[model samples]
Target: METEDDVPLHLKSLAAFLIRHHSDQLRSITLSPDPKLHYPLYIDFAELMNEDPPLAHLVFSHPIDYLRFFDDAALWAHKIVFDKLKFEKAVEKIFIHVRINISGSPLECPETFPSIGHVRVKHHGILLTLKGTVIRSGATKMYEGERTYMCRKCKHMFPVYPELETRNSIVLPPSCPSQRSKPCEGTNFHYVENTIICHDYQEIKIQESTQVLGVGVIPRSTLVILKDDLVDIVKAGDDVIVTGILTAKWSPDLRDVRCDLDPVLIANHVRRTNELKSDIDLPDDVIMQFKQFWLEFKDTPLKGRNAVLRGICPQVFGLFTVKLAVALTLIGGVQHVDASGTKVRGESHLLLVGDPGTGKSQFLKFAAKLSNRSVITTGLGSTSAGLTVTAVKDGGEWMLEAGALVLADGGLCCIDEFDSMREHDRATIHEAMEQQTISVAKAGLVTTLSTKTVVFGATNPKGHYDPDQSLSVNTTLSGPLLSRFDIVLVLLDTKNPEWDAVVSSHILAEGEPGKEKDEHLAHIWPLAMLRRYIHFVKGYFRPVLTKEAEKVISSYYQLQRRSATQNAARTTVRMLESLIRLAQAHARLMFRNEVTRLDAITAILCIESSMTTSAIVDSVGNALHSNFTENPDQEYAKQERLILEKLKSFEEFPDIISME
Candidate 1:
């Protein structure tokens, strides 16, 4: 037991502060039946700062030392509630966690939390908060924290602790002190195993999210060590904000080796940032802005929707249909578990089969930018192992490393030149796309990793695209995989002088966007606000299909099934699911929690545009030059009336949809 004078002044003060503020919580932990179990006391850093400013400073600067005091303070506080003898029964069981949160809070600034690349040698031994995606996690191991030793010369008892300055090694005392005034030389000591203190330890590497990095800049990663309750709490692909002491670990020693020191974080707290809203905090003002924007165009809902659509990829001249598809794909539908306990994925996949120089890669890049967390890779560069999880031998230990899709678990994945991937590799993602999970059984590792990600793929057609041929023949993609996409838009670069002239004028006028008063450019949201808006709707809205919406969607499915032009593989049950998801996503885009008939009609129109097998509305045409009509509301009304009549003639289905 450490005496009052044996503890450091700063640590003692911190302990006192905890006892003052969190006595009730500590009492509960002490009263628990299991003495060997370690309990976590989550201490919010901001609250600590408010309660005790200097103590907060001490914790921020000397976390490794102050955190130990916190644990010890917890012990004394618990002892106050319980007996000293009982509290001392298991010293290792009493621990308080310093759960620092800087993600969406005021403490998230660069001074409190810095990017991985900004960590320098000066930051070593300092408590720092860093945010990144977990790329790899090591096996849990038992770490020896404290051990008792008896001096061989003077029979003096002492404790040896792991040294943080040199990879947590223990140094032997050169001499033994006798309080009676005699000092004896004790170069050797006997190890006492009975007084050992140990805890669970794990190592994980976190890479700074590429979404925050500049173009072409490689991401930086730091090794993190988790102890006690922190082990296994986070896995690969999870975004986490870790607060810990920055230290360096020496590389393995070898002949003629320089013995490099790698930066490592001894984590005091780790908070996962997997929640959609937490990824991008939508401010009240921004939500108000969205509401006001929509309110201004309420009479013309399609106009308001077009305003939002124009915000996407505004730098590009115009591909209104493609832009709308991108927006819906990002703000995906709601995921629900069916009656059979099977999950129906809400993630909407978009495939762009276009001609070369149709800005296919541009859309891919733009979509990646729109997403808060995204991974962009070309099909040729990605293998099955690279797109999914893989087990690799790292530092003589097998560990699971996340791939592109896994790393972008909660967001989007853009694969350009998607056709260049091997068929085997393409086949591997079939389960990941539909089941929303990747089943791994490789290298003696068997585990399922969540891949709840939207796949935005772009690939050029196989030579010249033929409308008469099936999608499989044109894009060389399997029908099963093609069916997974909610929207498959074809962007053909037809040489029309009039259309080309308009596109050319738009492109030439791009540099002077600020000077133009064009309505399309009037309500374009900036990248930051757009990201917040997308995440806002995705996190908050879970639109359910109205009765009318259900009937319309069901009728469309039956129509597609009965249409002579139906492709058997493409018009299956999955297409119905896709229609529902698309309708729900459209409802979200309209800022509504109910999927109305209008939302259903818009979804059907998007589906109709991609009907490569049927000639529902002009068969198929180049979507690259598709621009918003002059009066979109009237156009929508006309299309809605025609579709309703079409549905009615098939089976006398009454139209319940209203334009108002």
Candidate 2:
């Protein structure tokens, strides 16, 4: 006759009777001036630290593990629950708790206790309250008036002191008042089951007082899945809160960690949140074309469909930063996946080289997080099988889950530690990068997976870079793979104390991080919106060569000959395509009928700015052919001097000889 909800119904009646006149304010209240800071309840963990001493010299080893145990309310009531708790300037010794019930004992208690009450449990041979107060130490133990009790029915023994009341005797409110008031009411407790209340943004849940289960937190750098409503809040470019079951990061050995959430959650959240409405001002005909393209491509899924690419073609005035480069790179591109996983596909790939601590990893992480599809990172020694094709024994047959490139097929693959990748694995990507597909042959599984991945990768200088500036690709990535990338952005961590101050201030709360990085959603999310924009334009974008644009581009190739040995005409043409595609994409973004002169000009300028840097290097390398052996100290000077010399020589040297 007793169902679970019925028992809660019973307890609700008794709780109301006992607390009918009590004021709600009697619950916990914490005061702190900084709204951003969390005020955690502290306990004297010094005692627990002493009892469970860690390995020598390992102070608070396994902090994450230690944090996990506090889920038990028995631990909360007996060892951790605090009275008048405040951890202001002091290190907050927040003791996490988890409960384990002792059966076959004289204590005739229910299987679990409610979260609000004092749980009576035995630990370390002592009968203790959940608040860490000793109810009854033991018969042989020394305590004030410790009572001994025996249950006749169970024939088991327990130590019970008169001060501790039985659960049936103590009646209270169904819900804790602390969570029912003001801001805490809606945000603090989310109703799950009829009797269960999830606290702390629903990432954590509390059972009855006897048991507290705590799930592990995802790494701050992790890609996590958000719930349906939470996904809606996170629009493209807008920084939205994402909350869901946290999953563990993949280990080096690729073993499963049950601690994290399922991947299904991520796929569903991305699909739902990526939905967008068509721009209102678009022509009816364009809209029809857009719809047709969506239908045709909807079921024909490509790799890398998660990144939102925005193309802005303004002239370069300010110095380039990773944030700026990544933003620029996204303009007019397809976010698809391949054998490599989710990637951003553009006319050109991007390679970033810099010193350590230059915010390279941070930039990559930000882009990967913002992108709709998955972003998989790999390092040196990462195998082709591990990255492109992974085979598993599936029910007596080989099953492949796919590699980072394959998963990123329709999105971007931003690889950190790029130079560390083994040459064989590095070689495997050359085809994928160029052909935009990977042909696999393993265990009789041969197929060409779409690999239109736009690779945004970073690496440290081979050794210590020049103490003065950014590291060049000549030093970090192999020349072959380096050539495959569409654009190579150099991130320099400078010592200009003023810029350093600004960066530090921004990362800290001292200065506002430009526009919250969240406001860009209108231009950022619905990567599908932009893709449709591209699809609409490509149908009629029969881009003819503007005589002026062609001349400007040809002059660019001639200038390249005046500078370096590289046959830059191919590069020049590729850059032209990148510009055309980018122009079309930008035109779409602006709701234009067709690509215009302004669009082409904008694309030309951005592309030329990047190519100019390469041209300068080419000229410099030829002039100083003997001085630089790709060695360290001389490399920067060699490259710089070569560029300057080429700049000077351009006036005298004929274009053909200087170029290739």
* Top TM-score hit: 1
Q: Point to the candidate with the largest lDDT.
A: 1
Q: What TM-score number comes out for model 1? A: 0.92
* Candidate 2 C-alpha lDDT tens digits along 1-660: 223353343234322321232212112312223323322322322333333344111212332222332322222222111233445322222222221122222221332211112222211112111110001100111122223333333333333222112211223223333422342221222222242212221111111111122235221122332321222222111111121122232222334634332121111112112222212235787577545544553432110111122222111112332333455454444333558674444434666666676656766765564444435476764687767766555324554435667655545677888888887787888878877778877677666766656678877767655524223333544555655655565544456666555545545563444644432322233433444454444344344444544443444445654554443432544454455455544444333445554444344434433442455434321110111122322343354344334543656433422221
Off by over 4 Å in 1: 1-11, 47-55, 83-112, 152-155, 164-169, 177-188, 253-258, 276-279, 513-522, 564-566, 619-621, 651-660
Q: Candidate 2: count the clashes.
A: 83
- Write model 1 residue lDDT over 1-660, tens digit each, in one string: 466676566656666776777777776676566767667777777778788787777777877777777777766656555554364442334555545554444466787688998999888776788989999999999988899998887888877888755767988766764454655766778887698889899999999988788978889999999988899999999999898889888876667979888888988889887874365776798788878888888899888888778778887877888998898889988889999999999999999999988888888888988888889999999999999987888667789999999998988999999999999999989998999899999878889999999999999999998888888889999989998888899888778899889988888877674695444324776777778778878877899999889988888888888883546667879889989989999999889899989998888888887777652555334678788777889988787877776776665456534423
Whole-model Cα lDDT of every candidate shown, in order = 0.82, 0.39
lDDT of 2: 0.39
